[model samples]
Structures are given as structure tokens and as C-alpha cells.
Target: MENVLSSLIPPHGGKLVYRVLQSAPGKSHLDSLAKIRLDQNKQMDLEQIAVGTYSPIEGFMGEEDFRSVINTMRLADGTVWPLPIVLDVSVETADQLAIGEVVGLSDEQDEVMALLHLEEKFCFDKEETVIKLYGTDSLDHPGVRMIYEMQPVLLGGQVDLIRGRKSETRAYELTPKQLRRLFDDRGWSSVLGFHTRNIPHKGHEFIQLKALEDENCDGLLVQPVVGKKKSGDFKPEYIIKSYEKMIENFYPREMVVLAAFSTFSRYAGPREALFTALCRKNFGCSHFIVGRDHTGVGNYYDPYASHRIFDQFPDLGLKIVKFDEIFYSKKLNQYVQGNSLFPEDENDTLRMISGTQARAMLLRGESPPVWFMRPEISSVVLDSVRSGIQVFEG
Candidate 1:
């Protein structure tokens, strides 16, 4: 059948969506919708779509929120799960979705509105219905999907809604060009992007420092994920503060740029790591530091799998700073390379701590080793936990 996107956008300009679809095939319309009901959650399956103008897509189409349609999926009981397809959007598509329009979607057959549910209520205003949609592709995320699906609306919202906040670290909005220029000016000959929700532990510090020293990269972009992380995670603002404090205290001001990555964490591990690099590349990063279990949850991915992706990255136009996992070796009494057991420190062996272990120790009112954290920061974190006030909210 003719692609549904063809009917949705200008004949000539809808080609990008067509390209995206061709690269990632969508499920049939029937299957897509069924999977939505079955999952009882919104997901971007390739099949679902929304119609709108161009300008709106640019403003409202976000990777954090996009409502698309996909194919139906089935469960063991033979229950059907319709594919949760969302409309994917980008800056260009946003403009197309909002040409001379206030609301992007149509009410009639040619431009019918897709009813989106948010917070238990249905809003007919197409502009307010964007929700997070998950898909398998690394580069395409809810933020990117929103840009793809609701760009026209978001472009409008970008001006209309001004109250919701981003953290201070990301508060200074830089044009894409300015961002590129900032990297160039800083001698960030190779920008290496690093994303995390936690404060820097020794392992993270070790690997990042190694990137600067070993890889001879010009600079590092300490981009922290400041969006919806799982519960028990640090708040974006807190993370921003932590990074700011660390940079001010430890890292050279000229060598690093601390910025907030305003996207939620998917914990997709290796794929997520690559996606992070591509996003940074979009922001002018030439290199990305991929640590062990970049975004893995529950031991699903091999630690080395995260770095192995670098092998294929040359074909993908992104470079990575791959290092063996840094860990604290109890026997050596210091951190050692994951691939080897010898102490990294020639004289004083100081084992590094893991984020997971740090969290576990903190919840129990224990101080993480100095090698794992700064004493002052760890004290503040522990005190916050003890007060029943969570310093970090995932």
C-alpha cells in the first residue's frame, strides 16, 4: 500500500519521513494499534502517524514526547498487542507540520486528530498530547521522535510555553552553531560526550581523565542526563550542581564543558551508548567516551559490549574513546583495569568504586571510599539520605 506518510505531509517535503520509514520498517496499521492496547502504554512502532503542518513540528516535535502508530504484537495467551506507532519529527518536519496553522493535526479524514491520553485525561488540543514513545533504534528517541511527530506543535509551544524549566547547566540556550563554535574555541579538537545521572565516582573520573590523557582528545563534554531517570536516581538539577562543583573544584575550566542532556534514560546499554554519541555528534562532538555498561540495567549487556560498538562506529561516522572498565580491586587495594588485574597506580593502589555499589552503600548510611567519591560530596549525599530527603530522584 502507498505509505501513509505520503498523504500526511507535502508531497515533495515528506521525503525525510519516507527515508526514516524505509530504514526502519513499521508494522501494519492493524497490528500497530492492537499492540498499543495490549501494552497499555504508548510506543513508537513505525506504523502510527499524525498529520500536521511544518512549523509546529519544529517547536513541539520532541524526542521526549512523540505519539506514533506501529504494528500489533501478541502475548503468550494469544492476546494482541497493537504496535504503538508515533509520528517521528525533526526541525524541518516541524515547519511542515505547522504551515500557517495554530494546531497541527486535522479533524477531518485527510487531517484527522489522534486522541492522546496524558495523566488520565484526553485532550483534543493536538498541541498538548505529546508522550514518550520507545523504539528499537538508537538514534531515534522520544526527544527525536517528538521532533519528528510533533515538531509543528512544539515549535508553537516553544514560544507559547515558557514556564517549564530546564536545569541551570542547560539553562543557557546556545544555538547549534554557537555550540559548535564554543567547542572549537575551547580547543575541544575532539569533543567526547559523557552522560550519567550520578555524581562522578572514581571509575568515571578515571576513565574520563584517561580519555584526555591517553586518547589525547582536546576536551570533554560532561553531559549529564537530567531528565526522567528511574526512581532512586539523582535529580537533574542536583546532577547539574554536582558536575558544576566537580568541574569548578577538579577539572580545568578550559578543558571541559558541563552541559545538561535533557533526555530521559532508556537503559538500553550498548545501543544507548551509541545513541548518546550520535546526539553529541549532532552537537559537534567528534568523540564520545563509552564506559562499561553505558546505560545497561540488570546485567543484561556484557560490559565489553559497550566498547565493542566502537569497532563498527567508523562506518557510522562517529568516534569513541573506549577503555576497559575501571574497578577497585580488593586484592590490590586500588582500582584496576577491567580487562587486567594489575594495579593502575604504579605505587599507591587505590581501588575505584562502582555507581551501583556507591548507591547501595549510601542507602545504608555508609560513606563511599574516598577513591570512589569526594569526601564533601559523599557527606552531603549521605546526610540527605539520612534526613529522608532524597538528594537524587531518578
Candidate 2:
């Protein structure tokens, strides 16, 4: 069959970025990385670049690209990029390497992961980065706290993945290349991408099904981020299992594809939403769903800020499907758009369960109502909680 994806939107910047090395480096080159190792977060960044998930971003941002992204949400060459993808390093580490030098990137076990061809080593204003990207300087936000805790120096270079890390949730991990191929094989010309860091609630499913119907898309890609998240958030294992159960019991199997992306959440609200949409574009998603408070944390961002961000960027490669806050109408006994009204109610009687409320209910051995979430999903969450799994506390 002809590839249906031939008509799908192309990757951002008109190319899919893949930086994995074609051949292994010599032993002498590997010996140089003996003392330098990257943290888990940086390793995840490298993995994204290698798999073309962060397409159009071949490696860490240079000083020019970093400043451009922070100040104007664009790359140095004027590509629409919302987040700064920089490899941070300590002052001592920066002092050891010179510009144009290549250094090996390794994990905690001293396993060589990638090789960084250094172009520039610069220092960034942490406060500026926090304010620009996250819209807050307060350490109360997890994204802000993470930026404050990063090393003082930033390393900019094109990275070549020497060895890739194995994902714990390997079965659900699909790279951009693989997703594009799958979409082609399935004869899906228009695929809608839905990104989430939380378990599937009724409101989420409602939006997904609504988008699929409204856009008349051929398929839906449910991609969840399976990386380090704040406390009280759902664990990766529970997330995968819950999603698997939800898809099996609820969504049409052939119409939906469940996958996971390995990347840390910055929780930058509007900016993260745009960043996510661009990433999804690289994954061959023609349309992206941007709901209220997408990638938000606490009360830092306005509820509809994510939708507004997309409105501001008109040329974003993928079409954005904006959704208003959806809630379950007790009077109608079904999910309804928040702006819509039920004839039986004079006052707004729409109800929606927040993540905190759902988590608390599950912890207290209460199952969320069918209108809120599937019992199958709740069972997996409750089982994990009972087994003493670490959840995002925030």
C-alpha cells in the first residue's frame, strides 16, 4: 500500500533530527570520558535527540540559540522553539574542556552514552531562564526549583549518541521514526496526538474522542511522558498499565496507538505545551490537542494559557485542537463542555475531579465514580498505592 503519511505534516524545520553515531569511537576516545558523567536528566535529553523526538534540535542549544529561545521563543536561525534545550555542567567541568573539543558523556556507572562535540561553553542567568521559560522565579514550582539546582555552566554542542539507554517501559516506548512507520502502515493520513503526564480521566478521554471526531482524524496517538516527575504524580508503571487497561476496555484498538516518551517534565505551562506540540509534530502527528492548563503545575499559569500560546504562534507546523475545560454534568449524567449548559440546572452544576482529589480518594480506598475514571484504571492506581509506590507529592 502507498504510505498514507505522505500527506501528513512534515517534521519541524522540515527534517527529522537524528544524532546517533553510525560507528563506534576508538578506545582512546572512550578513555577520555572516564571522569565525566551526566545526570539522569541530561541522559534523557540525549536520548530524545538520538531518537528524533526533539527534531530540528540536533543537540544542546548554543549561547545564541539559548538566548533567542529564552527571549523570543525562537531559535537562533528563527525557528519557532519554545524551550531551551541546554546541557548544563559545573564550573569545574567547564574549565576542563575547551571550545571545539569533543568529550564523552557517560552515566553514573561510567558507561559511555554520547559524545559531545563542544562548540561553546557559556554561563546563563538562572533567574532569567526561570522567569522567561517558566514565568516564575519562586522555588515553589518544581520546574523553577530544578533550574535553580542546575550547574552554573551550560555546555553547547552537537551530540552523537554512542550508546542508547534501555527504557524500563520498553514495550510502550516508540521513537519518532517508529511512530511514523506505524502511522504509514496503518494507512492513517491524519493522526491526532494527545500528551499527558497523568492517568486518563473521563474528561481526558472525552477530549480525545471529541478531537478525533471533530478533526475526522484517522487515528489517535496517546503519548505519555514516562520520566522523572514531581512527587504525588502517577508512577510510570501505573501510568502504562492504567493506559493499557483503559485503551483495551474503552478506546477502539485499531483507532488508537499507546506509546510513551522518555523526557522530564518542566511544567512550564504554556511554553511546555508549545514545546510538546512541536515534539509531536516530529512524531508525525498532524494535529495536537491543547487543553486548559496543559503541562501546568500548581496555580502559576492561567487556566487557558496553553491555548493562548498556540494562538500566538500561528505558523506552528502541526494544527492545534484547543479544548475548553470539560466537566461532568450531574444533571445530564454525562461529560459536557464546561461552557455548555444542561436544561435541568439553573446554576452551573458541572463537576470535575482534580488530580489531587482523585489521588486522595484512591489512597483512602474509594473508587472514583464511572463518570470520573474507569474502574480498571483506578484499580491499577490503588494497587500501586497499596504496594507503596512513590507518587508525585505535589
Best model per TM-score: 2
Quantify all predictions' global Cα lDDT against the true fold.
0.49, 0.84
In model 2, the Cα lDDT at residue 269 comes to 87
Candidate 2: residue pairs that collide: 231-392, 231-393, 232-391, 232-392, 232-393, 233-392
| RMSD (Å) per prediction | 13.9, 2.5
Per-residue CA lDDT of candidate 1, range 261-305, in tens? Answer: 555554445656665665565555666777777776454567777
The top-ranked prediction according to lDDT is 2
C-alpha TM-score for every candidate: 0.58, 0.93
For residues 1-394, could you state the per-residue lDDT of candidate 2 as single tens digits? 2243376778888888877778988888688653458777788888898778887888888999999999999998988999889888889889989888888888888888888889999998999889888887898888889899999999888889987776688778888888888888888879999988788888888999989999999999999888877676777777777888888988988999999988888778889989999999999999999887888777998989988988788888679998777788777787877556546566757787566677778867688988898888888877766777654444
